[model samples]
Target: MTSEPAEAEPANQPADLFDLSHNVNFLLRLAHARGDLLFNEAMGDLDLTPRQAALLHAVDRCEGGNISVLTVVTGMDRGTLSEMTPRLVKRGLLDRRPAPGDGRAKSLYLTPAGDALLQLARQRTASLRERVLASMPEEYHDLFVKMLAQLVGLETETRIVHDLPTVTRRRT
Candidate 1:
């Protein structure tokens, strides 16, 4: 019997590009590195890293919040807070106490010094943000920020910040 012509296989691009350069994760990392450079340059007297500023900013938004909440919202591991929080306290920028509802949870509050520094950080960071978005189409700025928020929000939700193991990689 004459066989019908075999159906042609539909050609399709890969579901994910194999090249690292084309990977979204690599792109995000590259973007983060570029941002760090810009942030460091603009930080000037502030000298806070992007993550540190973000932590402080989150605390400001919380008004009076606990480490558990901060860890979830800030995407910072407890070890990170252990290192940075003490320094912030030493610098008179942060104060900690037992959470109102839960004594086991440590609550964080921004000091007047922290408030002042936050305001200045906002100003400096605004300038840097503007510079970063300068080359992008002005209309895309809102979309860019929104998209990043969506990505971060989704990623943060998936992570169980409290489930971290005790041992940390040695920094060297």
Candidate 2:
């Protein structure tokens, strides 16, 4: 039998090839999980998820804010907002009124209770963000936020109408 030399592994290979802690996708997921954990820990007593709080904030901020406007601002899908709106209404945190021009559409507003809770949530989350940023270097703060915004296309605008491909059925 002929003897051949074994190939050498790359010098820069990681200690564990499967270790994904530094991977972009893995890190994004971990960061999201950590954010949720911290948010829950800070605001769990308020009985609102982060997204719910965001929706309330959006409703308060968006001019003539309705579900469609919220979808654009919050990046939440229509179906999700549709489902979430009623729950908040049930909790007495939101008031849904028929839009002036559109009877079928709803314009959302925060109730007194919702506004109070949202104010508290905003303070807590702001403090939480400060703490989170404190853990990282000051120089990286803006860059970090900018990078995340780019990832999510935070500045992208949604169009009400777009071209659609026509589909034709083939006769068999």
Candidate 3:
């Protein structure tokens, strides 16, 4: 049988050229960093990190959310959450105690001070978000939020698969 013609190789180019993966990663990093900078500046007086505000918000909804739940909800590592919990506790923004039924675990609750700070942080974050979206059309805002949610959902699914050995190793 006649051999099939060999496929032509793509032309060699600089690493920066035609590197869509790098470009996408750079764009993500820049957008997140810039947004974080703007948010921090906007909420400077609130005396809370973005994650701290999120934790307070979560605790507000859950009443007595524990570290494990917060870890799942916030997508933060246990070490980071452990580190942050005590600081928030020291700031009078949160209270941590042994869980009612689980002696091995600690539960987190937002203090009155924490609630007040979270409200302020939420207001500032909303204002900043408004300013950022001011240039975009209203219709696009809904689409943007939808796309973000989709991305987050995909990320969560990937994390879950990676975390579960049976799921990760399953045959297609």
Candidate 4:
């Protein structure tokens, strides 16, 4: 009897040799976690979580913003934002009101206190970012941003390709 040859695994599999994509993804997660920890530590006195800071910043930029807009801007889910919004409102950092055009939907606004906190959070975040990037040469910053943007664009394209068939079929 003749034995059939075994199929080769895909190059991008976890067991593949020298997979730079997996290595880069792992490093990205690690860096993000470390950055979050550092940012939270820096904002400890101000009592602002990173998500809260982001939400406040979004509200400051888009006054009378709806929850849908916040979800898009912050990439946070409705449930999480719902939970956080009440707390922020209670703390006088945010104002939540029913939308004038849509009574069932609510809009978010940043109070003066929220603005102040956001400014402080920006300063803290900027300081932390500078410290992290200090070892890298200034000339590399633009290049780094461009490379990261390319990676993001590629990922977005892949997502669109994967989802387009399902989305189109759903409409039919």
Leading candidate by lDDT: 2
Residue range 1-172, candidate 2, lDDT tens digits: 9889899887536654446854567778888998888888889999999889978877776534677777776778999999999999999999998877889877788899988998899788767887667778989987887788778866532221111111111111
User: How would you encode candidate 4's per-residue C-alpha lDDT over 1-172 as one tens digit per residue?
Assistant: 9999999776667665345556877778876788677877788899988889878876765567777766655567889888999999999999988877789988788888987888888777767777656768988966776676566543332243334321111101
What is candidate 1's lDDT per residue for 1-172, written digit by digit as tens? 9989998655443544546666787889989988888888888579688878977876776646666566765777878977898889888889987777677877788899988998899878768989888889999998898788778763432243323332121111
Candidate 4 accuracy as TM-score? 0.69
TM-score of every prediction relative to native: 0.74, 0.77, 0.73, 0.69
For model 4 the local lDDT of residue 126 reads 68
lDDT of 3 by residue, 43-106 (tens): 8778777788767776665556677666665667788888888999999999987888789888
The deviation in Å at residue 41 for candidate 4 is 3.1
TM-score, cand. 3: 0.73
User: How many residue pairs in model 2 have overlapping backbones?
Assistant: 0
RMSD in Å for all candidates: 8.9, 10.1, 9.3, 10.0
Task: Flag regions of model 2 displaced more than 4 Å.
Answer: 1-19, 156-172
Residue pairs with clashing backbones, model 3 = none
RMSD of 4: 10.0
